[model samples]
Target: MAVAAAQELDELCYLSAQAMGSLTVSEHFHVIKLLGEGSYGKVMLAVHRKRGSPMALKFFPRESTTLASFLREYNLSLSYCTHPSLTRALGIFFSTPDYYVFAQQAGLYGDLYSVIVSEEGMEEERIQRVMAQLSGAVTHLHSLGFVHRDIKPENIFLCDSSCRWVKLGDFGLARAVGSTVRAVWYESPFCTPEVGPAKEAEKEWERRQEEGTEEEMEDTWITVEPGIDSWALGMLTYCLLTGCFPWEESTHDDRRYRKYEEWFEIERAHDKTDCYAIMEERYRENPPPSQFHGIGSLAMALFKELLNPEPKQRGSPEEILSYLGGPWLLGSEREQRRRAQEAQKEAQKVSETGGLKDELLREGKGER
Candidate 1:
């Protein structure tokens, strides 16, 4: 049958790919089909030859980047390896001049974006489970002093079994707490614009260029806080519940940016637009979750808090966990509050410390 022939060809491709370059399939891992491909690399599904456990192998081009860059990303990804709601990075392998491979635990059910699109309608319980898993993953990342930077549905995967454990993966853009240069659109609105050299800076550079005295542009960057991740989380929740992007305009409105801008201005002028009012007026502001046949007010509230434009006002992961009635809610909230108190104490201690030993003494007292 045609299906049988296709399967055979797929097997051949998998075997050949596993053997490509420096990778060997000995008795450890048997490569399956390609899982997905992105701008930087590709992910392939492989099963442990002896144990039969599935895993993912991501291949990146080492020649295209420096060792420092690879090491930074590797270390950041490693920090979350122990989180149950996150995909585990197994190891990194360098086989050929063209490839830098990263192996990780595989997800059986693929990404949430594809799953939701295929199923058409996800049950309320399923949606909550996915959100809770995502919240936990994000919270863990924040606690570890890192930002995922990208939290879209395509990056979230599900396990194979009936339980469908959600796992947050794909850390290619993740960075340390203070690093900026976040992916466009996903950047927090509260963060300053990622504009190039200011007009004055550019003009000065031009004048210096004519005189051949121009200094190289210093690498200026911004600092994004955990609040930005919370905003993207809101957007993802909205998309999952509505099956459409929060800012995407409907065809009936011609889906034009100009129209969207106009509507945004109107909404800004009058803050009294109800859910129905916004949906009917702009057609770009997505319909409320309550408008969705199966979704309810709790879902709507979650989305609203997540997407609030003000960064300081955005809900913390602890707050979100509490809102969802997650098991970790109470403990996480207490931990967050404790950390805040400790931070305030540390700040006060620093103010009183005239020298390094004073700071150390304060820390010693706290430890005791």
Candidate 2:
């Protein structure tokens, strides 16, 4: 019996050593499943051989110019993205000359895009929370002098089953406040106007070249404005609340530009404008389904402010927080009614005082 026990202990130690063997990009991680695949590369759900920890391993093609850009952003995140809403690249390994892998926390529920576009859309309160978190993350990035040019549903990963926690990932398109590059880093219909030429859409780039205007000196660097990210955030908010883009999907650059230009012209003609330009015209021409309505006035107001056609007119991340904090200037129906009542009472008091209160005004004038 003693010999049998000794033999069992020896076997257990050998197994333990095997499990704890040296970890490497190729050897340490075993790919359990492919999480996602995209143009850049593929993401795999992997397990650390020795630690047995679940990790999301993202692989990138090395030969592409995008690899360096992605690595730069990942390195930046590792240094400064400590916020809960931002996903961090925990570890990295060069599996081969042609491939790079990064280990990060795996999202159980997948990305926000899949969730919203799927049959189970999110609720209004949940949308607010998601926006709040996204706002916080963007604000943090701005404070650090960086802008996440790509702010879309696909990049937002739900960290919990409740959909309350999320982490913004994919910084390949992100850039510093002062730095500029000609390449568009992300592909989504939610990009801002200023981000037009330099987006993931090859059609836009091709159009610029065809127009004989895209040529630049090797060292030319356009100063980037962080406001573009804010605009994208607005687009993101609209998508989260409505589960669809505000405008019809346009694949060609000319088509997208025409829609924007027409809306801008209409906006310049009118004194009052909502979140989008030519909204009435769009509705009249192509009315969305009934399910698109009822996103609430407060949300719409915020969306309009964020999606302001003119980049300068759009609110900064800080300003957006203020709006959200005040619940969008007495945004609720009851709050609006209360505000109107206060205004009426103030007007009545002014009438009673008969405009500037005679004696006090005279005394002030005499002193002057």
Error of 1 at 203 (Å): 18
- What lDDT does the true structure give each of the candidates? 0.58, 0.64
lDDT of 1 by residue, 196-260 (tens): 22333555667888998948844444565677678777666656555665344222222342343
lDDT of 2 by residue, 161-275 (tens): 6679998988767766766567443345565566554443455456777889766423223456677887788777767655666554322354553554454454445444443
Worst 10-residue lDDT window, candidate 1: 186-195
Displacement of residue 267 (Cα, Å) in model 1 is 12
RMSD of each: 19.7, 14.5
Candidate 2 lDDT for residue 101: 62
TM-scores for all candidates: the values are 0.60, 0.65
Error in Å for residue 102 of model 2: 1.9
Give the least accurate 10-residue stretch of model 2, judged by summed lDDT: 325-334
